[model samples]
Target: MHEPIVEFQNVSFSYGSRVALQHVNAVINKGDYIGLIGPNGAGKTTLIRVLLGLLKPSSGNVRLYGKNIKEFKDWHKIGYVQQKATTFDATFPVTVEEVVAMGRFAFAGVGRPLDHHDRHRIGDVLKMVGLDKVADRRVGELSGGQQQKVFIARALASDPDLLILDEPTTGVDVRSQHEFYHFLHDLNVHHRLTLVLISHDTDVVSTHVSRLLCINKTIMDHGCSIEFLLPSHKHNDVKKNEQIFKRVRHKH
Candidate 1:
């Protein structure tokens, strides 16, 4: 019962002289919905990149599905929606179907056309994300929120057990933000897809995630969201640390 889907053991990373992360130790168990929150310049993104194997740690190890960081493979098992997925020019010609189909290719490999099963899976994910109606439309023509939905559909095309998204609702409208979170809820609730959602929006994050990891070059605090923000005097130290989060968010 000690198995974790993802593990970071004393992980640290530096961009040359600038230290981005420091001794980050964490574990993502199966079926976890984690909200990784921190202020700007915090190591949230750095930790994410290291987890995805985009950046090698200067020290310590990261493991995916219990494999050692250096030995892990099968990256297609995890889906990632990186920063600014909707920043493309409005004239870009790729259709929504084409964008989602890219995820199929990621799983099936280069030069392999979609078979019947692959096409069905593609259609199913599009419908699940509520983008089936606009499958033929140009992805760039959609609203920022709709485009982000397409990205999620693409990420789901592979039916990954784990999904990682960075600022998925960054340019989305307020209403769309709720809708997107609803879709995420469905994924985590119905499909049991584990998630690591990285954002600076504390209000939105604290509500959705099962666990909250507060990071700032290192972890400030982490635990269940309810207890993490509770007003209990017995947990005064934890409350004070949460105050640092509030101060960081309020500092403008």
Candidate 2:
């Protein structure tokens, strides 16, 4: 079941003349829970954009599910929940179920009414996220944590195999954040979802994820989260590893 899902080969990206990422190489396998951590302006978001096919790399290749991202068309199989759900307009008039139903548009097609299967999927995802009670409630009325869950449900409505979240806990409370990570853990272990989480909270990420991919404009380190948290002396390149860990820990 550990099949390759995402592959980055000698990938490099730039913004104008400023280099964002350089010669990055990594493989994310199916059922892997990976925490992607880095400092501010560390090219973490750039790498994600490249993987999502939003930005073309200056050099090298990105493959999603063994297909070159350029040719990959099964976008619904990959779900993405972007940062800052609380920042969404509170006045938007859509209901929670409506919002989640939007995720199925790719399969349902634009200007087309949702079929029974699509409606059932929307309900299943909402129930999966524990938001079935609020299905008919307006989305803007929900709390920040609930709003985050709604987005997660929206992403899940597509029935994606791989889920990617960018700073998902930004506006959530501490208690909610704790519960949120537990929910993510359940998705990874029980549902067999492949998760790629990008977060600034190193301690939280390290505790929850199976593997850690540390980066700062390059592939700084890649290994099990336990290995990453080990004492400096245990590493082959102790100085570089410690520095990268420190930079990630303190900066953000």
Candidate 3:
């Protein structure tokens, strides 16, 4: 059955005087794969931070799974693959398996070693993301696309119901990007994962996402992917290419 997984109610946020998000309201339902798009400094990342509870809304409320986000604690149910994961140092010397294993720490606390179940789960997630063969290889040694897969495997290790990704295709090759999109679609169809993906390219995601939310500090528009790119809404396109992508914060 469909249920609201994440909700924003008149949500507003500011960095002292500068506003990042204003009166944003949205209902994210189970099995809904929404593509969040916006021009530079449009608070896309800020909204994500708010949803993840990294920032508090200046007004209104945010909820996850029907509970206020501030009070919700079942973090393992929500998985995140941050944009910075691609820039991880190749010289760090950690193996792919070791990095993916980091996801287990959320369930088993720090300093605890993996038991048989944990190891098996790690292998399963690795295979799910097509990284099992390279499990023993140094993460830094893998190509950029392969490294990105490792981080995705790490996020899926928790078997989250909702998966959030920020610019997941950044730095990936064209072929790898298409593969990533297909993988996400498979996850949505087979695993019934509710996804929130932030991307700069509308054309790329228009074919895959069910919904599109266009924002510029506030929601300029939102609707089905087909309706979003219509002639009437074409003005919202910040660029035929990428915009001045920046995550602005309301700093005191």
The TM-score ranking, best first, is 1, 2, 3
Which parts of model 2 have CA positions greater than 4 angstroms off? 222-252
lDDT of each: 0.84, 0.84, 0.81
Deviating ranges (above 4 Å) for candidate 3:
221-252
Query: Which window of ten consecutive residues has the lowest lDDT sum in model 2?
Result: 222-231
Question: What are the TM-scores, per candidate, against the unseen true structure?
Answer: 0.87, 0.87, 0.87
Per-residue lDDT over 114-159 for candidate 1, one digit per residue giving the tens place of the 0 to 100 score: 9999999999999999999999999989999999989988999987
Local accuracy of candidate 2 as per-residue lDDT tens digits, 1-252: 679999999999999999999999988999999888776687888899899899999999999999999789988889998867667687889999988998988666799999999998998898888999999999888888899999999899888999999989998899999999999999999999999999776667777787778877777643434343444436477776666556445432
The per-prediction tally of clashing pairs is 0, 0, 1
Over 86-107, each residue of candidate 3 has an lDDT whose tens digit, in order, gives: 8878789899999899998776
lDDT of 2 at 166: 92
TM-score of 3: 0.87
